[model samples]
Target: MSELSIFSYLPADDPEVLEQLQDRIELVRHKLKFVELVPTVACISSLSPLKLAGGLVPELIRLAGGTPVELEDLAAADPQYIIVALEGSPLNTAMSEVETLMALPGWESLDAVKNGRIYLADGEGHFSDSPAGIVETIEMIGEILNPKQFAFGYEGEGWIKFGV
Candidate 1:
């Protein structure tokens, strides 16, 4: 669990709010536990230099029924879905960044690209490190990864999926 990160952003003295958020997150996790398809997913935190995410993001992916693609093995990982959420970037800016990422040499070679399973998230609110945002991010990714099984109404605002 990323309780440390979520709790740090919240009030240190207010344990009640933290406890409630934790319980909510656990409920979401339990629901995702029976998910049928655990797809490979890669989360990109940067665009200019092509920096992939690590640390807490991957744990959230696992909880949302996905296997986080290894940062060092992007090509071989063949991730089924890719989420790009540059920090401080809104949905529009993230869309532009997705265009930049698509221009990379082997971008189309990935399974995600070929299948049009790529997604762009709003960084400011959707993928932030705050307690409530963290829980929403899980639902956002869960809806993207398992459309048939889960939908927390984060489709248009929090994230937008690109379909080819």
Candidate 2:
């Protein structure tokens, strides 16, 4: 199989740092040449289920340049890799989304095992002290799923883009 590339379209970050990271991330994109982009963003707290149904999810899929997996199919397929990007710290708010992801039957038992990974991108300045630690934790989760040495990656401030 080819190297799966998933892109997380997170929200606004610290304006000052975001400028630089945007350039770097674009460079990385060029280097990686990711084709299978699964674009995603952190869902804010203000959304209602009805509103999400209307256009929110669709927008994310559009941004990713791909289609969003149906909740039913997601559970049934049990993909080997998944990446989720957040606007803020995962501990603070992203966890809620994680809960939602976990609640899905497709993902409930599905886990990203070795070589499979998760990433944090386009986040605000609310991250913890050890960003590497966080990435490790995510990788560990992948290991749990696949029992292989999955590696987690993070792009600190470079992911945030202008006007986002």
Candidate 3:
């Protein structure tokens, strides 16, 4: 199994918090261990179980072009894309929150993950102030996924294609 990079901001010092975290981690590890090959797209998010299980989860199934193991079930889980789905303001607005998640044990230690591909999936459309905002968002994901494949520019009217 490759390194597991977890995205979370749950405090680690508290006993109750630690126990819960350990339990969740164990579950995730167990699940990830079942997968056998690299998945096309892995939707990594901290969304509520209901929202993730009901919505994003299914979309990811289709996006992956093959079966995708839950974040917990990934065995060789050196994540290629760390997709962050946030509501309200852009994820950049919550820099501290992002940093906290990055500081989590698994994420902080993963040296292989290239930086800045950190995605800010803003469904609230808060960045509509800039007509090219969607393109910028897509560019960020592209950069994080593969800098060589995507050019950093707005393709008129927020059209974007990240080398997925």
Candidate 4:
């Protein structure tokens, strides 16, 4: 048992923590009330290799109030939202990646692509492999999914629109 485990770090047994968590949950729920329905989201890590969602990626999408689905599902039915995660900063490369993905067959048919719901995630210290990146990632995803509620720019915050 590592002392640094999430089980030990979480304040699961603390009533105050629970109350605070509940409050935040309620706030998020209230903010999303006008959303009507959550969209199905697909996360793509790469275009050439065709890497798809797994691990924290799906969890982040869920926290953002979108249903995470596999890339294969995109072929069967298009997802309403798409998140493309880049390796690092220098948005030129990220934009190129998005262009490459859009060039793929059937990609243009996706509702997300047509509706401008496609996004790119890349920034220094914004998206990290460490667990500490979860909060920022969730926030970024929330802003992307519901800009009306989480209104914020993504340019310097590790996220950005594919062309905008």
Alpha-carbon runs more than 4 Å astray in model 2: 1-26, 33-72, 86-91, 108-164
- Segments of candidate 4 deviating more than 4 angstroms: 1-30, 87-90, 123-129, 152-156
lDDT of 2 by residue, 86-132 (tens): 43344334434545544544343554322234332322332212333
Structural similarity to truth (TM-score) of each candidate: 0.85, 0.32, 0.39, 0.72
Candidate 2, position 48, lDDT: 22
Each model's lDDT comes to 0.78, 0.33, 0.38, 0.65
Which residue runs does candidate 1 get wrong by more than 4 Å?
1-12
1-164, model 1: which lDDT tens digit per residue? 45456546554577898777777667767887777778899898788777777656777787678888876455777789999887767888888765688776578799999898999898878677677877788788888988877778988898998764
lDDT of 2 at 64: 27
- lDDT by residue for model 4 over 69-154, one digit each (tens)? 77554666588888777544545566766557867668777888788887877633444444335445666777888877986466
lDDT score, candidate 1: 0.78
**Residue 60 lDDT in candidate 4:** 60
List candidate 3 stretches off by more than 4 Å.
Answer: 1-42, 47-54, 57-69, 73-76, 111-117, 121-123, 126-164
Question: Which window of ten consecutive residues has the lowest lDDT sum in model 4?
Answer: 1-10
Best by lDDT: 1
Winner on TM-score between 1 and 4 is 1
How much is 57 displaced in model 3, in angstroms? Answer: 6.2
Q: After superposition, how far is residue 126 of candidate 1 from its true place, in Å?
A: 2.4
Residues forming the 10-long window of minimal summed lDDT in candidate 3:
1-10
Model 2 clash tally, residue pairs: 6
